[model samples]
Target: MIKQVLKNVGITLALFILMINASAQKVTLLQQGRAVSIRGLSVVNDKVAWVSGNKGYVAVTKDAGKTWIWQQVRGFEQSDFRDIEAFSDKEALIMSSGTPALILKTTDGGANWQVKYRNRDTSVFLDAMDFHGKYGCAMSDPSNNHFVLFETTDKGNTWKAREMAKSPLARNDEAAFAASGTCLNIFDNGLIKSNSILMVTGGSVANMIQAHIDEKKWSTQQLPIAQGRSSAGAFSVATNGKNWVVVGGDYQRDTRTDSTACYSNDAGKTWKIAKVTPTFLSCVQHIDSKIYLATGTAGTYLSKDEGLTWTKIDGGSYNVCIKTQHGKLTLLAGGNGKIAMFSMK
Candidate 1:
């Protein structure tokens, strides 16, 4: 009986070890190497996440970020991957700047990334990409005069170019970093100012506003931004499957000064500029209810009352926030060649 009990205990211990290993996968930082700049990050789960940047590098972690393994792509080792996104543990994509847009897709995680599409006919830079199941879209800088929307239905196997209205700012061929989509937003009421040219297209502001994605499909209500004066634009957008938050820039035309952040309870329909202590903001991530994180020139800010207020955590730190399993927050912060972590709790 003693021997049997010992054997049962051993089996139970073994199972527990396996579960822990599965939960905490590895997270490799490509920025670990000298002269590497970590530009973008995306996490599918706690055990699985990806990061990309200059040096044509990409890294993956399956052990909850305890360790990481570096992966390389052909003809991209020297090119910069500005943005990355993961649909699941097994699928991911990376976007880079080039005359003919460069996009990389992987099926077996980051083990092998295949070039799915490239647009050499245009000089526009692909900034961001989004894929929901087999449907996805890519956004590019509008200076190239080429359309910004590229859709793929067969799991990014093939892409179809979409159209957008021509404007003077678009130069008859325009695209913005689809990275944030029109998702780019920032605060205008704060002290941090934006020097970028401010442009507002969507809203109930008469026929002046238009929805390029859909004509009658108003999923979000346009918020009132006081009248006459325009607020800064956003650099990133995050949704908790409920509230939608936008953060980034003042849409300044030339200055790096960005001071604007907004949130909407009903998708994108209406927005209320956050009344937080004024500070420059960048990327926004929603870890959970009442818990939010935004990072940029002012570093990372934690807000418990939505974006109504913000408190700076670290100075001179740029972080891309992600949600992990078990309601944990992952802050991908550190300069090129260095990576650090800060728990949400």
Candidate 2:
């Protein structure tokens, strides 16, 4: 009877610990009501960050999130700058979706932007882009049954589309989500931890696409997330070297929890659907080896036990959440120019 009593007590203690880990952070809003719907976020460090959104809005902060200098690119007032990659307070690249796909680079902070790449095709829609040192890759929806890819060797100043033979083939109705710009990234991480480009697609089918630096071909793994429609599937993926976490659901059904998240430890060879998942997540960032953060239209969530379980710690609508590239400072941004900072409680 004493042993049984001790076992019950141990289980109760563990449950309590998990509960504490679930609500481990506090979110503080730094800005709101600016008339822009932010979807692009990049944190250069604890002291610098940038965000881009619809209506050609781009905001940057040099003193963390204390104040933001907002800009609306001239001659592109209607452009929706959905993804931004920042190298510092003054140099960055912004990509726009919709008809007449565009990529622009700004060297004088937000003062002027020079077009680096432009496509006026009615069917072309750029989704996301990421960099590895000076090498950068960008993705667009299918063209000629294959995903169009562009690469830049000098940061993002110039771009050239990869040969059509090298681009990954897309299924009949498969496409990528441009919600958070976290759905695609290039990193030297995985089982081997070498340079690999990873991208997630959603539509009639959901899949993960990977291309290794040493290999000449692209490979894919199906993600077990919401699918069969345009509004579902994986939206974001983050990894702490080897372990990977992917989160997304039917954005139209933002509150449903089933098939909303999953995890993989052995690269993309296999995955296990998270037992506890957050609602329709557009962005997820690895906070540490064991902690991760995700956010979407529903709210923001945190996971202390990797991606096994997540708890809603704040009820803020956001399109993207990110941590500083080299610092621990974390921030979230969404529509209506909402921006918030997350710090450990």
Candidate 3:
């Protein structure tokens, strides 16, 4: 009888420790209270990362998130850098939105920036930028009944227009969210031998995954998320070839809990709504095949069971969360120039 009682106590203790660890996990602010609003973040490794934002603000942190070196591109103070991609501590790219959509690159840390792409038309609004090695692309809202995409093969030194014939026609009123710079992602889709550029759209079309499968074909699958208005619907998506997770909600109604998240395990043959969803989680990234971290203006959430359920680990507002592509580091960034460190251990 004593042996059984001791074994039961051990089990209870183990579970208690796990619960404590889970609850004790919270984001630690490393930077904040600045004037700019941060949305774009790129964590290249455990020790190197970068973030870009409004008013031409860009920052680099070499000691993880402990400190940052900030700079505003000398002559571009009015630009809103919506997305950033960092390849290393010294090399990075930032893409601005709004009229005069621009792409800039820096090689000597943040000291100097060279414009690589620009469009001044009123309709040109670049949303997000993603890369798979030297091959990369930037996406913009639909124009003239078609989506606009730009491709880069020589890093950020040059960019080319994707043939309009290859870019699939966009639905009426469909658009992508730039709130977190995550609505468009490019990586190996696993189904095809070549990589696929995947983009998620909102607005009247609700949430749909638009996959540029190859040079000549495009495919799509819809995600069940909040919609019906300009401010509602999916804002971000991430996939590990098989299981896919999407998170978003009405950013204008950020407190609503219904239909804010969903997941698909069979590459979008079907999707299941998250039982416990985050409120207005506009961005999501896979920590592993099962774990994911998401955030937005509402707060931050962590999911351990493939996004079916989540725990609101942080109540502080953030626009985006990202884990190191090849390391264990994770970080979150948001408005007021807030940057915080997070851990999944």
| Per-model root-mean-square deviation over C-alphas | 13.2, 2.2, 2.5
Candidate 2 error regions (>4 Å): 1-23, 190-193
Quote the lDDT for 99 in model 2: 78
Clash count, one per candidate: 47, 0, 0
Candidate 2 weakest lDDT stretch, 10 residues: 188-197
Instruction: For model 1, state the Cα shift of residue 31 in Å.
Output: 7.7
Error of 2 at 250 (Å): 0.5
How should the candidates be ordered by TM-score, best one leading? 2, 3, 1
Assess the local accuracy of residue 230 in candidate 3 as a C-alpha lDDT between 0 and 100: 89
- Number of clashes in model 3? 0
> lDDT of each structure?
0.55, 0.89, 0.87
Better of 2 and 3 by lDDT: 2
Q: Check candidate 2 and list the clashing pairs.
A: none
Query: Which stretches in model 1 have alpha-carbon errors above 4 Å?
Result: 1-33, 143-147, 165-232, 250-258, 324-329
lDDT of 1 at 288: 66
lDDT by residue (1-345, candidate 2, tens digit) is 999999999999999986776555788999899999999999999999999999999999999999999999998899998899999999999999997899999988899999999999988899988888898888899999899988998999889998888889899899999998988888985365466788998998889988875466888889989998989988999988667899999999999998999988776789889888888899999998789999999999988777988888888899999998698889999999999999887
